[model samples]
Target chain A: MKTTFSLALAGMLLSTTAALADTTITIESWRNDDLTVWQQKIIPAFEKEHPDIKVKFVPSAPTEYNAALNSKLDAGTAGDLITCRPFDASLALFKKGQLADLSDMKIMSNFSDVAKAAWQTDDAKHTFCVPMASVIHGFIYNKDAFKDVGIDAAPKTVDEFYADLDKIKKDGSYTPLDMGTHDQWEAATMGYENIGPTYWDGEKGRKAVIAGTEKLTDPQFVEPFKQLVKWTDYMGDGYKAQTYPDSQNLFTLGRAAIYPAGSWEISVFEKQADFKMGAFPPPVQKAGDQCYISDQPDHALGLNAASKHKDAAMTFLKWVGSQEFAQIYGNALPGFFPLTKEKVTIKDPLANEFLSWRQSCKPTMRYTYQILSRGTPNLENALWAASANVMNKTETPEQAAEELQKGLASWYEPQQK
Target chain B: MAQDRKPVRWHVGVFLAPAVIVYTAIMIVPLFATLDLSLYEVRDKVAAFVGLGNFAKLFGDPNWSGQFWNALWNNTWFFVVNMAVQNPIGIGLAALLSSNRLRFAAAYRTAIFVPTILSFVIVGFVWKLILSPLWGIAPDLLKSVGLRHWFAPWLGDPHTALTTIALISVWQFIGIPMMLIYAALLSIPEEVIEAAEMDGITGMSQFWRIKLPLILPSIGIISILTFVGNFNAFDLIYVAQGALAGPDFSTDILGTFLYRTFFGFQLQLGDPNMGATIATVMFAIILVGVCVYLFGIQRRLRRYQF
Candidate 1:
């Protein structure tokens, strides 16, 4: 009996040592849709490279992620690896010391300043998260619908774009523009931000607005709203009540001509759209003008400050920044273009078309994402309402711009002065 | 001597302890904590006592005050819609069901009450689909009836969105008041009803002159319940219109406002201080409403003992 007890204790100690040898780190994410991709491909690849470090991808619904993660962090139960949102949301966590400073990490060298800007401090001194991927905004059109409407090529200028819309509208079968104001964010994101870059001259106007040299009421910003108002003329009947999914269905069902799209829609559209789909960057105001696109950095990964397995988590993050991880993640999620300095070949054709825009057009982040939205009457939320109102014909472009300017000037110090 | 003395009755305390402890832990503690939190603001990540400064900001600041007042006005309208439309319809349904002449009363009651048990997510999503122009049957159904023109995008229009949502909510909760009033009508002792019948109070007059007064207390209770529920309503609007309560925030009520402030929406970060302040204001409004019902109206109501 004594010999058996000693042998059992020894075995238990050996098993404990074996478990400790392989550090298991979990990743908290909002992308529940990507669970299978992480489990089947990404995790296995990482584990093979680092046999001693095990990885787990745990995800909650996107809508509840922020609240859920915050409570977990507070309770000291957050995962070792944290999937970060692009801007102020992650910055807040870093400020509270819930996320570790990854500025000194060797993997930080893999990304450019533009890619890291989303996760960096306002002063751009310390970086907290490793850049993962970005989604480019443009217009996706049904090729068959375009053909039926007697249009052969994507429009090159704003006037030409409207002319195509007019042709599509005149055709009587297809809705010219497949978009809606019911989910207000789309009105701002895929509607305003998608085209506003062309008018604002991309980063030039975006930076100017942040610097307080140019107000939202400026012509550069108001022009986009004016353009959005024009889009209402081509939208289908009852477009006012149509939702995001409704618009997607309308486009994919080949009933609509063009869809103002984010590159993220590529995977879904590829699967759903039976007809050949083509993408075009936002048309410039005139032919031969310099084009701009809103290539917003959307998601990234970071080390949780309270993590027990910091070294193992760092190893995973380092692998995440590698060319191998980018290729796999970029291909697995076609629309999510990896933000690495190293070149990556995209597998999806629609995504490739979106990526091709980067060659000709200048890339800029969404204007309100950074410091401009930190104050009351949050600029991002205001833009959503304003954009929706503009599209609904409830607010004129000038009025919308003035409201935004007034709201910004209320608390934003530079704007006030 | 022992037999003459009163028992210690320690068992009574034991019996009450579970409920008292649970209630205090879940309800009382959170209520006081929320009130306490309302008095402080977080600056530089540290919570400091601000002593109603947040309230001042909520009221005095144009930005905060604008949203607060808008939400408050919308909440009042939601309650008013429930009082005006839901309760009357409920009473009518109950009166019809209580009459022995009506057949399959149980089936009708069950059918009407079915929506009350459905989750808000299902109700919101189902209604959205039903009303959608792209896939919804609303337009087709209306067209079949030659009333297609009447089917505007009510959910999408800022002018009609709030009323549409309120009506949907009324549709779901009408059964509550109906069941309550039904039970009240059934409890009217047969002798009292018979006495009214012999006095030549029959048909509609019998309902108004005899039965209505007796159920006045139940009606009052239903009104207060509707008021409380409407003021606290959030899920339907959130699930339908989203956190911004958009199309120019026409559907925003105090509940959504508090949620957005507390949890933040999209790129906006949550501010617990402002959230607590808004919550306290809601608490005060609810308290005042309940107080008026209890002291002003409920006190004056005559409870019939037939």
Candidate 2:
């Protein structure tokens, strides 16, 4: 009887010892492609800072991430820290109280107002996540293509932009715009998002449209749709079949003159591009019109509300928002312009070129996010379809605008319940 | 007196139990669960029972019905293309390979079956590249044949995209029917062929009169399999054209549409209820097709015992 009792006591002690030694903090992210940075740099640096807590990086493919995260969240099996998207998707999680309230975190104070606002709940009192990176959207052009075509500078106006495209066309050697409309989202990202924000420059204007006080089919919105169609003319023959990676390769290989893409692509282009790469904001409608570059925060890290290791998760979140984190992010992941407001100067020339736009142009989130924050889902896909329709001449600009308004109505009516 | 008693056969029940349990758990349970989910509506992130509301919206609502009809029609076309193109070519190849004196028959059969072993993602990407007008070897090959002008962006054109995808799918899967029919053709008795040869019946005449009739049942099975597969095909289209199934959703099939509705693509939030509705509809479609094949088509095709 004494031996059995002693055996039970020993088993309990062994289990407790194992449990005490295993203080792991798991963080989930969709950026599996950047596993090298996470495994080799970020997690190692984090573990060094807190030797007691071991960081485990959980990853999913980007295409499957949201569904996987949502399933895990529903099952109450999500990781301690989850990388979330901004606006509606994050807002939904925040509403469900799935994310821990990070409003009281002192580290959040260092973040830019845009970053803070992006991850904030509808109440505006509580924010769930710490915004890590803001992607700058603009055209990354070949400087050699500009010089060969005898164009001195990146066009500041719509007229000059068209003129330069014509010169590049006249040069007869390169495709003016390297665009892959095959994915459909690429056009909406590089074309509509870039052009639409310039027309709908202010937040009030965007909010008014989403609120139904202003119409999406209005002339202001219609004009941007027209501009998107015009951009397609510059995307060479059989451009409809060209894919996103194919378009990027065309630009890097010097087959095309200009490539409109997000700042995230800078690191990739730097490694592949042969010639000098330059970037500028999408040219404005008229000569004097102020342009807005599409700037939205990405990979907002949130602590799961149900996490067992809340203190450890919070420690990591704080570390993620620190200046040291920004330095590592900017240096290792060069494309993303860090939103931490720290003076981490990214040495990549393409990154510098994209950053130059932030100095001169107004910053706007992707056009659909304004509508999406109001709880409209699939608005980006609708706009993507509309852009494709206008480009393919399947629908006129007016028709496409009407369709956009119709699609928004579907979301609006459903939400009214 | 002991010899008059019969032995108990408890092993039959024991052997069948595992399969029945597995099938019920994996297939039957999920199928019914999805059907049940179709009767609910998700609002504000909560699911509430809505009865026939989802079905009404699917068939009655213009926005929903338009996409539904397009997918149904596209799925029908996919099946029809496989039947009309894939099966015929497969049969022709199988017939040639089954010829008694044919050279390198094993090598030819292996070569034909190679693509069937490839994953949908690999095939989709490979075909997309081959059909791409830019950075593709197709244009140069066409030019070499003095048919450069005939080379257009077939996969990018809405009118051609669905057909192109169908053809690519057929190319990947034709080996399945070919092998099945080849096996069926080989099962023909040597005495029948020898007897036909004695009557001066040979080649096309012999094949048409004897082999074709014998293989009708295999062909029938292949058609049903193709119907089921075509309706369920999602991966290839998703990998190639993505969730939008563009060139303006020309390549949108039932599987892709169901996926988009359920999982939500891009800015869309996944609606499990609506997704379940689509699954229910797809189940009904597959059920009807299978029932018709089993009761109507398969019943008519006589499988002659070798």
Candidate 3:
């Protein structure tokens, strides 16, 4: 191993003395204790294998990850291999031609079919990205909490869901639903991005909107907002007081009987001392129980298009594609669900159930707020404001919908000018 | 002519040259380049001159007008909270601790100053978690008293989000101006204070009449600095809230708005042209603020050298 390692390094370093010596391979990898541990222990093995190449790690916090990466790209100092989020912003970068296409890499064939479809352009000849891990976000319920309230399991219809929530409250549970409108977008995230399109974009509704045949003021959009208000109202008074983590914490601590959130958060609840938490598909409508569940491609990654060291970059990305490495990585990552054929055995039965249950879902549609909703920055800002406004009653759902259409008209009309 | 030749102002220019070059290259050039970039439209990898179009869109166009006004309004409130809360608190602490009789004053100053040393990201997350209902010490502290009911998740609430963040910022930054004003307050000649004491002006009276007059310039300087730093600030709000400034964007300031516009989040493409326009507007806002302080406020206030 040393002979193989030393030879590779010695060749890379000596073969290109001055020119290649300066060509340092910079990797803008994420900072995770587990991932860092792997980088520290395993990367040196790769480095030892290739001596001429020296790796410089530019570690950034998760919050600063996108901004820092953007600054680096703007300055043209962005490194060879960078982590990519699956959000619409990444698509914006792809349009800018900033991302490297590694479609030709044999390792790409190993990607999950869903993962491949999400990252690649319509022309399968190009693949601009890969994923960190498969992130599964769906509605999760506490089975024990339900049983205590005399409900056996999750409801298949919207009516049964509300009935179960009522039962929980009737049983003297403080709050049946932990819908935290304190973060306004959480309401829309649950009401719209995760579910609205499930029905809105479905056969009858989408055509109406697309044909300009349906005003957003039409009951289609208004009904969801009203539904959201009702669901939120069930949380009792002082609803404005709830925060995201606060609601999640309440459910985990058993202060609340039920919660709606992403499956990615299962590991966080599992750390609680008591009670079992499990995942379920989004609540179905009694009128349309036969509709499909909305889903999206989760936690994806991509390579930099302008990377100087494509071979080494390809090697690293290739490792990410391997099911064995992905399984090892995902198991250690806690909340992540790897999309490889080889399953990493999860310790939490609830988390395992979520991963297994998700196989049947048909993703509703893919439009993160930042991307799909309103395209203009100012309009996006308004739409976001409207979410909070609806909760506060400062703006009605009809007003909110009008504001969005007006926002689009403002941008579109001006661009025409 | 040879004998009349001036000595080549040797060391000053020589010493200044490197710094001047570096500063001009790093700061001034980039600043002006950004301003110049504001006047152009991007197409086919080339920038075509578009006189005041970006500015027109930012200020005049209805599409952008609301967001611009909202951000401006939020930014104004964000700065006002700091001036009202951070500056006065800092000044008071500096004045109190400057008294020679105060015991363990050095320790107090260090303890107060330590938060300033933390990065914004750290402070944002630390305060966010601390104020959290889960794993937070703030709730427990409040619960210890009868005030547990008042323990709302401040950071996550839209109505209170920006104001809550402003206070956290003040807590982190109070040390900077505290140390500045403390030094200014300490440098006042002892003879002047002694005279005031002899004249029967003492304690609170002496501070108001004697100490504050002398430290007016320092206050003005700290004010301008707070204005500049607050106006330019992005990290604190950004970390506590995502780029979207969640909970309905109740916390969108010029900095975040500028960032989202320039960098393009979600579906929005990063428009260097528009970003430059936002930056120029910021520069104008900051310039007006500094000018008002220097020419207007400072001129009106008499700095008594007693």
Q: Which stretches of model 2 miss by more than 4 angstroms?
A: A1-21, A341-344, A371-377, A413-417, B1-9, B44-46
The interface root mean square deviation of candidate 3 comes to: 4.3
State the DockQ of every prediction: 0.70, 0.49, 0.28
User: How many residue pairs clash (N, CA or C atoms closer than 3 angstroms) in each of the candidate models, in the order given?
Assistant: 0, 1, 13
Give per-residue lDDT, candidate 3, residue A382. 56
Candidates 1 and 3 compared: the better one by TM-score is 1
Docking class of 2: acceptable
lDDT of 1 by residue, B96-151 (tens): 99999999999999999999999999999999999998889999999999999999
Off by over 4 Å in 1: A1-17, A20-24, A50-54, A61-63, B1-9
Which DockQ-derived CAPRI band holds candidate 3?
acceptable
Interface CA RMSD of each prediction in angstroms: 1.5, 2.3, 4.3
Per-residue error for A413 in candidate 2, Å, reads 6.2
Worst 10 residues of 2 chain A by lDDT: A370-379
Model 2 misses residue A114 by how many Å?
Answer: 3.1
lDDT of 2 by residue, A1-417 (tens): 999999999999999666645779888888886778788988898888787688888898766677778778878899999897877777777788888788998988888677787788666788889888888888888999899889999988889889999999888899998886787878777777777778777455566666677677878788877987787888877888888878888888988998888888877787788899888788887887877887877768998989998877888899989999988888778877789876888888778878887878887777577445353336777788888778877889999888877767776753222
DockQ of predicted candidate 2: 0.49
